[model samples]
Target: MFPFFFDPTMMLLIPALLLAMWAQMRVKSVFARYSNVGSRHGTTAASVARALLDRFGLRDVPVNRVSGNLTDHYDPRDRTLSLSDTVYGSSSIAAIGVAAHEVGHAIQDKLDYSPLRIRNAIVPVVGIGSSMAFPLFFIGILFRGQMLMDLGILLFLGVILFHVVTLPVEFDASSRALRVLADTGMLSSDEITGAGAVLRAASWTYVAATVMAFAQLIRLLFLRGMFGSRD
Candidate 1:
């Protein structure tokens, strides 16, 4: 059976969940507001990414348009920058800012950012851990097998570690994006402020995610009676 809704550890996780909800709202609000405002230079997100990559001597890194609202990302494996539908061809400030952020990841790959490198290395393991954690835990509990439960907790730790490491990677990308935008004068001061607002809001979501993962791990530990004399 699951823990009670009002259990102490469960209560502690409420704030993190609320913060995550708030972060989601903020990201959507800022993106929606700025997505309507066109940039002064009137350049599409794809064009801006290309310009930044070229400026950074990364002309070989390709920028490709992808389908989705906010599915933009940089593929380190292939060294490609993929922008979403809203960002790829749009001339809005939000689009350009998002494109720049993904390009920032590409920059990190090129410069061999240590945290990013570590994140990439563990991605496959994290993927497996995330998917198997809950199933293993539940199956172990059903069979009253301590070893299986322990193994599940161990795998779940990898998921937590991935989220923890992701915090720095995301923040660094945003910092790099803002710096590049400023140094190149690609966006006016006011425009940069707007873009910064959007990126900052987006970064909060990552923080919320990490907090949520930590809370989940702690809750699992509590359920496993890891806290002595608590059961």
Candidate 2:
């Protein structure tokens, strides 16, 4: 009996793991470096977020402070934008960049961005599938049940799809943030370059996630093939 999670297939995960770690470190390093650099106009991220939302005629979306370093997000369901401790009141370039990226999501929601809508729509199912995939796969292996194993593999595919769709959503948001930051004169031309660096660094994290998801999916398929062939 081959030990699960310790097989040769785990080697497939190595590059993905390294990339994910590098992405996290790169973003943090970039965010920290730019955090020391203040905005040219000293505009707080929260205020910038509010101004952008208002400009988009999404005046009803409220910007709220949430606790944490880089936990900022836009919750479309609640029509709320939450900025983290590192961004909410900070007038730093990185903070504003992060703030604007989140507002980009809000605007995507307002405009009904198709990818964003698809991502949001499948979220509930993805949550269920992601949670059940492994357990069911393991159970199938234990009982030598092909149907159970196939079902588990299918569930994991949903997670991979989520990661794939997420890449475009994130890229589009960063793109919007940069363009708007320039158009609104929120960040100076040189400062926009700095913000772009911060946002570009942030985007790598999503790319890393997608890479990892694909690697894991491949690992699962390899394992399933091994087990199925044995059966």
Candidate 3:
């Protein structure tokens, strides 16, 4: 194995990845149990969001439908809460739970949640850093330019930080989701507990993705260092 491959930095990755994958499977299964398209709760996603926002004093936020299942998100820039077509119209526990989760983000925004704020601030930086990091690192290694290699490492580190920071944001959203749902009686105790499990599992997807990204970063770093040393 390459040096970086054996590095202890990957110690937490394996479990995190496995947990994340497991969560994905669990969430999918949970959602599958209620996949009927005809189910209706008579309450629109917009209504749920409006009510929740009003309770939290965030009535200015607009709730709208967006395409794609589970693609729902709260966009802070436009102060909009976007939900999937299924989630917006469906009144199932899953739909309400998910809608509340996205709205939890809005709550986070309103409360100036630290992790969410940091994640948002780092978004553009992480994008640029991740994009240029590996390529620059490789070029640096090929050309025996330590500066380029170091810069790449630094950039890659930013991406890693962004990933690390995302964990709390996601987890906090889930926490907020459960609390809101229970507080609002959107879900019964059993449903709240069940939905919490699903959301927890869904969080693993992010964990897994972060692990995969970190793994790739490690692999690249190992290759560069080994090859560069030889050169």
List lDDT for all candidates, in order. 0.89, 0.93, 0.77
Q: Which ten residues in a row have the lowest lDDT in candidate 3?
A: 33-42
In terms of TM-score, the best-performing candidate is 2
Candidate 3 residue 63 Cα shift, in angstroms, is 0.4
Q: Residue 103 in model 2: shift from native, Å? A: 0.9
Winner of 1 and 2 under lDDT: 2
lDDT of 3 by residue, 69-173 (tens): 788899988889998887888766667777888888998898899988898999898999989997898788668887888788888888888889889988988
Off by over 4 Å in 1: 1-12, 226-231
After superposition, the stretches of candidate 3 with alpha carbons farther than 4 Å from their true spots are 1-25, 35-42
In the range 14-122, model 1's lDDT, one tens digit per residue, is 9899999999999999999999999999989899999999999999999998998889999999899999998999999899899999989999999999989999999
Model 2 steric clash total: 0
- What local lDDT does model 1 show for residue 193? 95
Q: Per-residue error at 132 for model 2, in Å?
A: 0.3
